[model samples]
Target: MDDVDETPDSVLAARARTGDAAAFGALVVRHQPAAIRLATIVGGSLDDAADIVQEAFVKAYRALPQQRDLVSATPLDPEAVALATTDAQLLIAALARLGERDRQVIGFRYFAGLTEAETATALDAAAGTVKSRTARALARLRQELDRSGVRGD
Candidate 1:
């Protein structure tokens, strides 16, 4: 398509399924705001929402190649949704305890899998800044998890 922005989701999805990074990037850009909003509604804050959305997109990107089609005909099972909601709630709660900068660093480094240099570019900061922020964020997240009684074992 001349305008990838104007391309339909199904078309983009199909292209992405075939390993078209541009098509997937376009899809992510198109749906990110709404996805973030939905995630916020479920996760209870913007920081948690961003993490949830980023994680979901990352999962989807990994799984898309194995799918026979982009859209599913079957509806979601209530039991599965309920089961996932509990885990999601816990993650959201943990993420919510982090500061905005902590969340941003965690989201870029862990959830989005961006390198220090890439995250620095995205945040318009120096690579050293990204590295330090990521280290601090992880430490804080670990403390939060420990306080919440979530054993890493």
Candidate 2:
């Protein structure tokens, strides 16, 4: 595919899954900056942000099979919908600023579109705990964004 054809994340993901190291490298190149920024926002130092991003990508790769399985079971297209929505990018950036528990809660619930019960199962926490963490993480994100001059009103 031409460079112009490289924008689709699903394509990149599929390539990466087949042991295409170049595709996986491209994915890392595409997402690392945002991931590192997220790591830094989550209280990691600049030096450690790179490491955190590396780890996140590793985790993303490892979880890809399950994600594919889930996608196959559902008809909805998360990639298409996410590309069309501004909230997707905002949510990713916001996730970087959350603590580990808060991040996992948000990632599983919002990004993964899992129900509270499903999130609880994935997180090994009570459903109520997932709900509470989601609430607190969102509130904290709003507060942080406001402080960072992201909130307009």
Candidate 3:
């Protein structure tokens, strides 16, 4: 019989979930640069950007099973992926303009794929507070990106 085929992301994710540091390291090698580019666009410096990206990926990995569950429960479609990618980019750009607290909120909510409740838990803030902060931070980032002529996709 032929070996079962698996997509690279699925394989990597599985390996990562199983605590294979090397597999996770490979995943980082594959995706970290894109994450860093996004973080730099949001965090304003190479060092800060790298840090943010690293944090985001760590958070992403921690939340991956939940994210997959949510996705599976909903729908797996191109539109969803496209929307998520756009939102991620927008949030990254916005995070770059924010202070530490605001950045943490956005990173946890958007990149980490956390719900408001989950975000509140992680941040030790009220859900309402997380929601408001996310909204305000996003609005400010939108304004800043617009002023900078970085059109949102």
What TM-score goes with each of the models? Answer: 0.52, 0.49, 0.49
Local distance difference test values of all predictions, in order? 0.78, 0.68, 0.69
Residues 1-153, model 1: lDDT tens digits:
469877877778878999998898899999999779645543347897787688888898998877887455565677998867765665667777888778777776776667999989977999999999889888888888778766665
Worst 10 residues of 2 by lDDT: 67-76
On residues 66-90, what C-alpha lDDT tens digit does candidate 2 reach at each position? 6643224344577887654655456
Error of 3 at 42 (Å): 7.4
Candidate 1 Cα lDDT to native: 0.78
Please write out the lDDT profile of model 3 over residues 1-153, one tens digit for every residue.
022233355666676666666666677877888877765554346897687678777776776555542213333578888977876666565556678776667767776578999989978889999999999877877787776556676
Score candidate 3 by lDDT: 0.69
Displacement of the residue 73 alpha carbon in candidate 1, Å = 17
Runs of candidate 2 with Cα error greater than 4 angstroms are: 1-7, 65-85, 88-138, 142-153
